[model samples]
Target chain A: MSDIDVAMARALLLARRGPSSDPNPRVGCVVLDDAGEVVGEGWHEGAGSPHAEVAALARAGTAAHGGTAVVTLEPCGHTGRTGPCTAALITAGVARVVFARPDANPDAAGGAQRLRAAGIHVSQIEDLGLRTEADALVARWQQAQDLGRPVVTWKFASTLDGRGAAADGTSQWITGAPARQDVHDLRADADTILVGTGTAWTDDPRLTVRDRRGADRPQQPRRAVMGLRGLRPGSVLERTGATVLDTRCPHEALRRLWALGSRHVWLEGGATLAAVFWQARLVDHVVAYVAPAFLGLGAPAVADLGIGSIDAIARLRLDDVTRLGDDLRLMLTPTPDPTEGA
Target chain B: MSDIDVAMARALLLARRGPSSDPNPRVGCVVLDDAGEVVGEGWHEGAGSPHAEVAALARAGTAAHGGTAVVTLEPCGHTGRTGPCTAALITAGVARVVFARPDANPDAAGGAQRLRAAGIHVSQIEDLGLRTEADALVARWQQAQDLGRPVVTWKFASTLDGRGAAADGTSQWITGAPARQDVHDLRADADTILVGTGTAWTDDPRLTVRDRRGADRPQQPRRAVMGLRGLRPGSVLERTGATVLDTRCPHEALRRLWALGSRHVWLEGGATLAAVFWQARLVDHVVAYVAPAFLGLGAPAVADLGIGSIDAIARLRLDDVTRLGDDLRLMLTPTPDPTEGA
Candidate 1:
């Protein structure tokens, strides 16, 4: 992207934050007048706010006439968080609409059609950075919805053979300090980090962002334990400023969370909880980091979520596969419902 | 494990490999007399190469009397590839044995039991490096075998949002150079790098180790393309020394390739190929590297593998997970069989 667009994208990114947007992409839109000053500015903050276009038009207040509305996502044609974004844009009298990404969710994927149908000038920059930032949380949320849960990513580090820690739990560092810190940064983007009480009890991990720079540390996504009876006084979570979602009944817990506000969640494993989430169909992504080391043998395999047939499947389509530092990371998303096959 | 066992455990780790040695661990066994001279060394290469114990005993020859053998994995009692390893060890007259990790596979999970039953000085060393390595790979493999396929890991690098490539397809460097090299190393461990012809034709990535210092660089692994048809002479495969496996029939093709000497393979991505492997129950493990980035609206997805019911299932118990520098990697294997759920 050009320097101007990059700055514009980041600014728009900062504007979009969603409470209901957990697992949903946080999007923002801005309309620049012919002279390049901001004519209208709006963002999708939390779930039920007026979408970017509506908010931008409302903020523009007659100044939107003949101005080009630069949007992060194609204006929505459906009434979701609010009314049709395309209609909003047209009613606001914007001369043209410049969008970085099209509405990706099928429900929202038709924004471009609606805008063009309304006879407004619609131009898609097809900028990648814009769309990527636009859909981070929402896309994963979409996958989770389509496939029945969140995208499950198993992140771990192992030796040449995949191992997390040595037997006896003396695993202080395997990949290196840098790699551990890398995880901290990752935790920042996650909506929540789901670890079993066992792991929290064993490691006493603070479960908060550390080993990074700037006050812009992780968003402090919610922290959770699998079982109902693991919260303790001396636990790592004792004073960590985070919410603990008890997921003994993960499906219901996730539903509660989704209803309240939770977009993505990370499963810190010990088998039982991983299985819980798996069975509950709550795990959205699986990030397994096989450290180039081993723990001889200790913890049990993440408990089985009782997946009987492939049909009771909590599906994840392998989206993109790559290698981390001496590790492999797999990206996953849910299979769409209709396409999930009857 | 105890501190005394850590050293021995590290030594045992040399044996483990990626998922697939189901019911059997990748093992390394060392035999020495009371004097502890390098009497013999053996690792589980795959099916039917002298089992580690037998190989070690055979190499020990007549000097096997009154010796202590340190093994990465516990010696077996039942026979799979050869006669019971415990029986062989006893017949060889070894006096004592030290194992870093106990055999978890049911067939050999009782190796320690058998060794103890034989009245030998058998010791289980805690904190064995071998344990961790074995756990990571075996968990997924066992899961896959039990569930009928390998694990699934998705690796993709985009924005924090989960975008893969830009709209215009200008994916020059989504990740840094080090990150790219890291991917090659991961591929090295893999038997194949499965991808669609679209990726092959577009970037013409060598898909081989360009960096020499990495392990995968020394001895390159196979590059197996999914849609291995319709190649132009000047295409990437034309110059790149890689194999093109037809995904039209994933199972049959894999079997054919196995017949053609493919011991392990890497499944590169292309939606069709991923879908085929996933649907056909051939994917044994999925190593996904997810970059904290996103690309909106590129390709629909990597796979639409025509999966119908969960009953067409190939499920995996979440095995090992970790974070790789600014990215997440998930190493997954299929769920293990009920009879031998490790």
Candidate 2:
């Protein structure tokens, strides 16, 4: 617990950053109590949960002995449906755990080396998993194991002089409508929310995820479409609940859609598939929605990402930095996936 | 030339908006003498000289009697490359003509009813062509002829509160290297310069247009690629002075791209082909280059043309702003075409 109670249990592992399965990252867990308060807080909401340290040690029962649990990765120790958050922090008697970064999944990198070989008193916090809304849940699985595919995070909603619409794509009431229904809870946990084909032919978008419960109670996600084809004859990507992908070879169409399962992908545009998956390192995490308004030129704050200078870029690495409504959310992690283009 | 000098030539033809085909919409044309300063001052720049009213009635050749030409758009009466600018402002006797906007086409819209059926003396200047920066070259060719394509006027430079790089992709010295070598003179009249596949897998780009005395230059627009099949092999779209389209239907993949000719197209991107041509409205125009600094949230400020709200926004309209070096440019015009989908 100390490192500020696992940095407030890694900011409650980002209430599943918009939802889950999203390249599966966002994670938060609390627990505290040596009178420091915050007895239990959970997170890791989708993919069938109980995890986030078994929902904060089942709400920290037995007052979790000497208190302290925190967690934000580095606490899995093998398992699929449950068990082993370092053996549920040694049967919840938890003398000390702390944790923050360190979890590039060799299957939970050995949960703090098996809680220091059972001696407990763990403690780790290396980069307290930076806070861009609690590190877009582990930079969306560390950019899906460094780009095998399924890990694109682009959340933009600008204005503080970043212009998104005023030159004439009208830009709908700039960022109001209650922050565009909070990006549909950030695309309901994104497994797919893409946007292109000229933003669905000038915004004919049904990218789903409603909130005021209007448009027949939306909140869908999985609406994609990248482009090259014309798309009009029956439109909305031929309707019937979407999934269009066609920006030809978009990282081999997202690695054959992550081997036909798709863990988490949400690129959603502003500069063409966010510069085609941040120049195909297949973007790992980024949730921007900056909206204020000036439009000095009118359009372009991010067009063309085929980068021609700075020797072409892609070593990113940051990790987290959050803010939401007036929007902001930088969570990067590149460095280790140039494998020369694949 | 008299109905108040054709109303100040329709207020100097609403100012001088375009054969925006490439930089040359310089239309000027003064001609005041009775107490006013210069007897004349023409301007136009390219494609058939003598435009700005036969270069201000051939520099007011015969100071041409009663003087007063003003002008901007309404002076042509027909003839392919020369002659008839309302018959050289009725043989340069230029008594009065004013002007500013009235050339919407149909063979140069009757030039103020043929300069009031040659009775000369015309007036005008109404919305002064909506007022300013050379009427965006007649709203960028009336938005590429009411949206058949060629309109995306975006310019980009970044930093002033808008950030184009920093959060890891670094953004190569921000906007130096002499404003990135003045965007190759804005890609030499740009007829094409797009990017996707996350800018060819995180910067393996080669959109070309460099120059220092033509450094391997092939000047004058041409270099596109939106979904460029799956290149992992020697990346950079396999190289060789590119021209790939890899169809998926960007409105019939742009009719096999006018059989390899060219007419103007720069959809440029990062947010999935700017959200697939900003939702297939095909971007028509938006040239932003803010520059001052902020990179805050992850990456991408203009990456999704796959539009979402404001009913698929394609009609932007602004036209021309300015600044340049520290960054600004602006100049949009799409108001039509773009029915819907991404």
Candidate 3:
């Protein structure tokens, strides 16, 4: 790998330390002295915080003079609550700058051009080897920005035979404790947790991220229920201050969620809701926890998505397979169908 | 490891080379000289062929005198088509004999006692570390002999959602080529392939073992269908000379299969039959090939097995998980429930 790739990987790791629920993209910066030694590093904490370049420059002090700054995202040229990061780097006397991903937001883009205009050397991390890691640092934010909607991740826990609940609807537990903890982790990473009104009425899930001891985490994702039917009057969702989308169409619900500043949506379904999202191709990622048990009769994990024959089956590429206790967690993404129009 | 353990492991490997469909146990023998160097190796060919000990003895000739004989199974004292292996070993003048597993068949057991009575130094492979490996060598045959029924292995191919077919009943294939080939390999290892009459009438599957190139293997397992209803007229089963076990009970079907000399029975089902076997606790082993695809509506891989709640779920311990092309092959065994009586 090139020197820039190594610095960008470190920058990505630092970026992950930032709050994922923030509307703004996470960014990390590393400032190097003239001798190619890292002098300072900083990551954006959340919205209204100092930009990564400004934070790094403050830590670097005089070492920023004639030095290089490596960042996970391009230094912003447009000012928001804080001044433009390009001006900060220029004022700090940094001679060279390297970035992993270019800022795609129209309002904050063109930092690379501004740096070049100021006669400072600017380069992007162009190594193909570091592209995936670099892109993943801001993949969900980038996707949400590109599509004008929250990136949806559909999650479910089911038996080996794909039953989500038993015949009598008693599904208190399907996956083991470890898998459930992993799901809580997933919930904590998202900006919103969504379910259908049917789930809200039938299950009345608290929809709160919790620790192993069952204590609710401080920064819980915003809970929301979609569909025209209203939740039960005494439902847990009503007590938990969850938003009611009041729309049967998945597109409208996602649009409202995007408007509500939800960049990533965790979709917990009751089969029928999942089918609608899948049928409309709204699901971006799938996380399935399959327990090594057989419930020969129960609610199927997913309802019909208009598939009638084998040729119409929804194919997914298995990205990762992990064993969490006795349950197998499968991470998958839909493979693009050549027969379907974009 | 002990020298005897190494020799017995080699003997087990040689034993596996014999035809699994043979009524007699596959036994291998290795004759070691006084210097602990192998002088000869032999495995029983089939029923009419010489026993493993006699074959090794014939190859050892004069070298057998004052040497050691390592066999996978105890040398038989009574003979059917050949002279007693004990008599042959005594004539060969072997000083010591080590066997991995004792013969359990009533007609052929007591070989160890006979060898001791003849004043030969007899030793059994008693190493705890090699017990599982040794037991697996003859597990199916021994189980059949002990239970008076064939050892049943239930095999099925399904989508990740536990679907066996599409909504339109069009399921030409669920798993990929590699998983299908693995199923054929499983069929080749079993003595019989049993399905329900409903499957025979609906699918009319050609239950024959075949190679990768679509050529029928010379040694195919016996195909049989069990149910009260008769098979459809002029089905593939009729053309393939499959037997009809006209009984709805899983126990009766297994009993008839045992009477027909089936030691290992591979149960390939179309949902209902699998549920019956599982409900009866007749499924000793399970092999599930899960394709990384979703069929939202289809025939489930298994029907209702009388479980109404999560507490009644049939749990299994995953023994092995393997990736076959794009599909996953899971090998599992039933976990004993403490609440249920044996």
Model 1: how far residue B98 lies from native, Å: 52
The DockQ-derived docking category for candidate 2 is incorrect
lDDT of 2 by residue, B1-342 (tens): 434444354444533332335322335566665444456566665455557667666765777556767766566655343236777877766666766655665544676667667677786555543334345545544555456545554445554335556555566655545556666766655556766556776877776777866474644466666564644457655655466677655665555554443446665566445555555656555665544333433355454443444444334444444444443344555456445332
- Write one digit per residue (lDDT tens) for candidate 1, span A179-227: 5666776666656666766777777766665655634353566776656
Predicted structure 3: lDDT: 0.86
> Mind giving the per-residue lDDT tens digits that candidate 3 earns over B1-342?
877788888888888877675567778999998888888888987667988888888988989888999998888866342237888888888889998777778788778777777778998888765556667777788887787788889998888888999999988788889999999998888889999999898887899999999899987889999998877879999876798999989999988887777888999987899888888889999999988889988999978989899888888998888889888999999887635885
Best by lDDT: 3
Best by DockQ: 3
C-alpha root-mean-square deviation, candidate 3? 3.5
Give the distance in Å from residue B299's predicted Cα in candidate 1 to where it truly belongs.
Answer: 40
Q: Write the per-residue lDDT of candidate 2 for residues A1-342, one digit (tens) a residue.
A: 454644554555445433556444556777777775677777766555566777777887878777777766567766342235778878777778776666766655667767777777886654443433345555655666665667677666655346566555566665556567767766776678777777777777667776666463333556667667645556665565466666555786677667655667777775656766666656666655544233333455455555433334334443543444443344444555343666
Stretches off by above 4 angstroms in model 2 are A1-156, A160-182, A190-283, A290-292, A295-342, B1-73, B76-156, B159-172, B175-287, B290-342
**Clash counts for all predictions:** 119, 153, 0
Lowest summed-lDDT stretch of 10 residues in model 1 chain B? B306-315
Ranking by TM-score: 3, 1, 2
**How do these models rank on DockQ, best leading?**
3, 2, 1
